[model samples]
Structure formats: C-alpha cells, structure tokens
Target: MIETQDLRKEFRDGRTTKVAVDGLTLAIPPGRVTGLLGLNGAGKTTTIKILATLLRPTSGTVRVDELDPLRDPKAVRHRINLIAGGERMVYARMTGRENLWYFGQLYDVPRAVLGPRIDELLALVGLTGAAGTVVERYSRGMAQRLSIARGLINDPAYLLLDEPTLGLDAPIARDLRRVVARLAAEGKGVLLTSHYLAEVEELCGHVYVIGDGRHLTEGSPAELTARTGGHRTVRVTVPGASPEVEAAVTAFAARAGTVAGLDRAGDGALVVSVSHPGEIAGPLTMAIVGAGGTLAGLEVTEPSLEDAILALNDAAWLVTA
Candidate 1:
C-alpha cells in the first residue's frame, strides 16, 4: 500500500513561500484504483510526485509499502512508476518498439524477457502496428498510449497516472481505462489523477477530493454524491402539449420557484432544476397530466461526481482524515 499522513510540500522564491500540497492524506491499496481529484492548481500532481519520489515533502509522513520515500527514494522509484499525460516521456526519434525496449533495458529487464514484454505492452495500448513506426509519426492519442506502455515496462507494483486521458478522443480514453482496470485486476495499486470525474467515478473504487492542496473529502463516488446536497435536474417531457399544458407548466414553475430556473429545452422538454428532485418529481409529473397533457418521459438526473466534488470544493468543509 502507498499511503500518506498530513503530507505537505512547499516551494520558495526569495522570501515568499507557496504551499503546493497542504495536509493531504490518502491511501492507494493494491488491486484498487484510487483517484486523487482536484482543480488544476489544487496540488494533485504535487502529491503524486511526492509518492513517486519525484518531490520531497516539506512535512508529514509518506510510505510506499511501509518504506519512507525520503529515506529509501531509490527503492520507492523501483517499486513505482508515473505516467504523466503529454508527449514528454517517450523519445520522439525512437520507434514505438525501441522506446519500450529502451525503457525496459533501463529497468534492467533481461533482453529475453524484455523483447516479448514490449510486444505485449504495444498490443495492450493498441500500438502493435505502430511498433516499428517512429514516435514522431504517432498521433497525440497514440503518443499518450505509448506513454502508458512505457510506464508499464518496469511492471512496477504501483502506477501513478497524471491526467492519463486529458486530450484523447472518447474511444482512446476508453481503451486506456481498460488498461488501468486490467492493471488493478492484476494486483498493482493504481493512483489516478484526473479532471475527468466520470472516468474517475467509473474506474476508481475510492476517491480523494482536494482543493488548494488540502484534502476536502474522501469516499466512494456514490457516498460523496450522496453527501452533496447539490442541485438535481428533473426533466419532464410532454410531447406536443397544448398551450393549456404550457400554461400549467408555467404556473407550476411559478409555484415551485426554482432558483436554478425551469427551462424549455430546444426539443420542447420542460427542464426543472432543483435541490431535491425526489420531493418534486411526482407532483411535477402530475402537473402535466392534470393539464390534459400526455406524459412522454420523466427522467431524474442526479448529482454527478463532478457536481458533488465541485460543491465539496466550494464548501471547504474540513473533515478529519
């Protein structure tokens, strides 16, 4: 397990000091995909770097399988690998196959073992055909895939991914997610940092919400959303409703008085935004029916992970970690 307690990091410029990670506590256990979520300047990447032994913490304790990263940085590096989103990791001049082979060699894997491992990784990232092609020719998504392949070359016990799917197309991101799932299933602890909350909710067993380098809250995606008393949308569609139905909807909207506003969608659906859709949905459905309108569909859109996290960050409720 890789865990931290009250971890903090600060940078200094002359007399000014800026804290990058402030009192962050999180745990990533083997066979589980844990997510570290925050806005761009929220210090998520700083925390990941500390665990990967890239940056030394200013305070608190960090353990990678019970070994102190500061005390045994070399051992920590050997046991973990970080795949940052971008084209910086792979060698642009090298072929996709050569890049993996080179990283494998650096990790000191035997050529006999490394050769086949490279092929497996290339296939895993859908870069098998592009294996012989120089990385310069690979597209952005392909490069990101190659970067993922390189991170796995060492086959480390822990993997840290920073924005692994930042700019990739939907299909490419889906494929990378599968790779992440496979890694966890194989017993490697995966620590993921991403702005894509839906992806995090889908892949992570638990998530740590952070802001301004401080821990906001940590829980299963559902728990976090349940804790969030944010707004929910109850969409009521009355297909080809008479003007009487529209007037009824307008009156209901007046009575309900949602601060988020009730809207008429482009397709003529009535979108009612509220803090509690559960309390209003039944009456909302009845209003259309009482107006002599045929109800086409009624759907409730719950508070998503992104919504919950944003609410959590905005509230800044401090919880004991």
Candidate 2:
C-alpha cells in the first residue's frame, strides 16, 4: 500500500506562506485503481509529487510499499513512478525506443531483458510503428502515450497517474485507461487523478475526494453516491398519454409531495427528477396508471460520482467559508 498520515506540504515566498496540502490521510492499495479527485489547485498534484519523492512534505509520514520516501527516496523512486498529464518528461530529440532504453538503463534493467521489454511496451502503448520516430515529430496524444511507456520502463510497484488522459481524444484516452486497469490487475498499486469523473467511476474501485487540500471523503463511487442520496432521474414510458392523463399525473405528483422537475423525454416518456427515488417510484407509477397512461418501462438513473463529489466539496467549503 502507498499511504500517508496527516500529510502536509507548504511553500513560502518571502514573507508569504502557502499551504498546498493539509492534513490529508490517504491510502492506495495494490491490485486496484484508487481515484484522487479534486478541483483545480486542490493540492492533488502536490500530494502526488510528495509521494513520488519529487517534493518533500512539510510534515508527514509517507510510505510507498513500506518504504519511506523522505528517508529513502532512492528506494521509493525504484518502486513508484508518477505520470502527470500535460507534463512532458521525455527528450524531444530522443526516439521513442531510445527514450525507453535510456530510462530502462537508469533502472538497471538488464541488457538481456531491456530489449524485449522495450519491444513489449512499444506494442502495449501502440507506439511500435513509431518506435524509431523522434519524439518531437509525435503528436500530443502520441507523446502522452510515450510518457506511459516511459513510466512503465521500471515496472514500478506503484503508479501515480495525475490526469493521465487529459487533452487526449476519446479513443486514445480510452486506450490509456485500459492500460491503467491492466497494471492494477497485475497488482501494481494505481493512484489515478482525473477530472473525467466517468473514467473514475468506471476504473477506480475506491475514491478519495479532496477539497482545499483537506481529505473530504472516501468510498466506492456507489457508496458515496448513495450516502449523498444523489439527485435521481426516473424515466418511464408514458407513451401515448392524452392531455387529460398528463394533467392527472402532474396533479398526483404535486399532491404526492414534490420532486425537482418533471418533463417529457424526446420519446414522449415521462421524466421526473427527485431527491428520493425510492420513496417516489411507486407513487409515480401509480399516478401514471391511474391517469390511464401506458407504462411500458421505468428506469431510474442515479446521480454520477461527479455529482456526489462536487456536492460534498461545495458543502465542505460552505461550512468553512
């Protein structure tokens, strides 16, 4: 596990001091993808840098695979790698293969295995054909792919991906996501930070939401959303309803207390937003039935992980403000 306890990091410029990370306790276990979520300047990258041994925490205990990054940065570096989106860690003049070979050699990957490892990684990241191409000639997406290849050269036990998919087109982003999942499945502890909430929902088995450098909450996406009782939308096939039936259903909904909004979907289905779908689903169905509307189907869409995290973050800031 990669873990931190009451982690704190600060920067001082002249007489002014800025706290970038504050009292954040987090854990990323192996064999799973853990999401690190926060808005801009929420200390996400700073926290990652600390764990990656690129920045020392102002005060805290950080351990990567039971190795102290502060006390033994060299050992920590061998076991962990941090890849940040929009950050170019490659040399423009180096060919993709040369970049990998250089990094592999740095990690002491043996001469015998280095060649095969480079070939395998090149294919893994869709860079095989471009292996001999100078990195400066590669597009942004291809360059980002090379970063992934570079990060994996050491086959570190822990991978920290901060916005790994940022700015890439959908197809390329998806390919990288698969690579992340594959790494975790191989028991590499993976900590992913991305603004793409849906990606988090799909990939991360657990999530840590941070705000203003504070650990706001942690849970599986479903658990977090359930805890929030997230805004839900229930769409029912109220097909071929007459004006009278629609009016009856509206009146019934009003009397049944309330929901956030009610409207017709493009297919003329009834769509209703509610704070508590569990309490309202039955009444809604009955209303449609009594109003003589055909109910062929009903589906409740729960609020996304993004909604839960943002709502919780807003609440926390409101309390502090």
Clashes of 2: 0
TM-score of each: 0.91, 0.91
List the RMSD of every prediction in angstroms: 3.0, 2.3
lDDT of 1 by residue, 1-321 (tens): 998999999999999999999988888999999999887789998898888888889999999899998888878888999999953699999999999988987888887889889989999999999999999998988998999999999899999999999889999999899989989999999999888899999999999988889888889998888887655777776666777777776677668765334567788765544445347778767887999888777777777999988888777645423
Best by lDDT: 2
lDDT of 2 by residue, 1-321 (tens): 999999998899999999989999999999999999989988999999998888889998998778887678888888988788879888899999999999998888899998999999999989999999999999998999999889999988999999998889899999988989999999999999999999999999999998889988889999888886686766666667777666776676577565435667788766544445355677777877787777877887778898898888889889889
Q: After superposition, which runs of candidate 2 have C-alpha atoms over 4 Å from their true positions? A: 237-246, 255-257, 260-279, 295-299
**Candidate 1 Cα outliers beyond 4 Å, as residue runs:** 239-279, 317-321
Residue pairs in clash, model 1:
none
Model 1 global lDDT (CA atoms, 0 to 1): 0.86
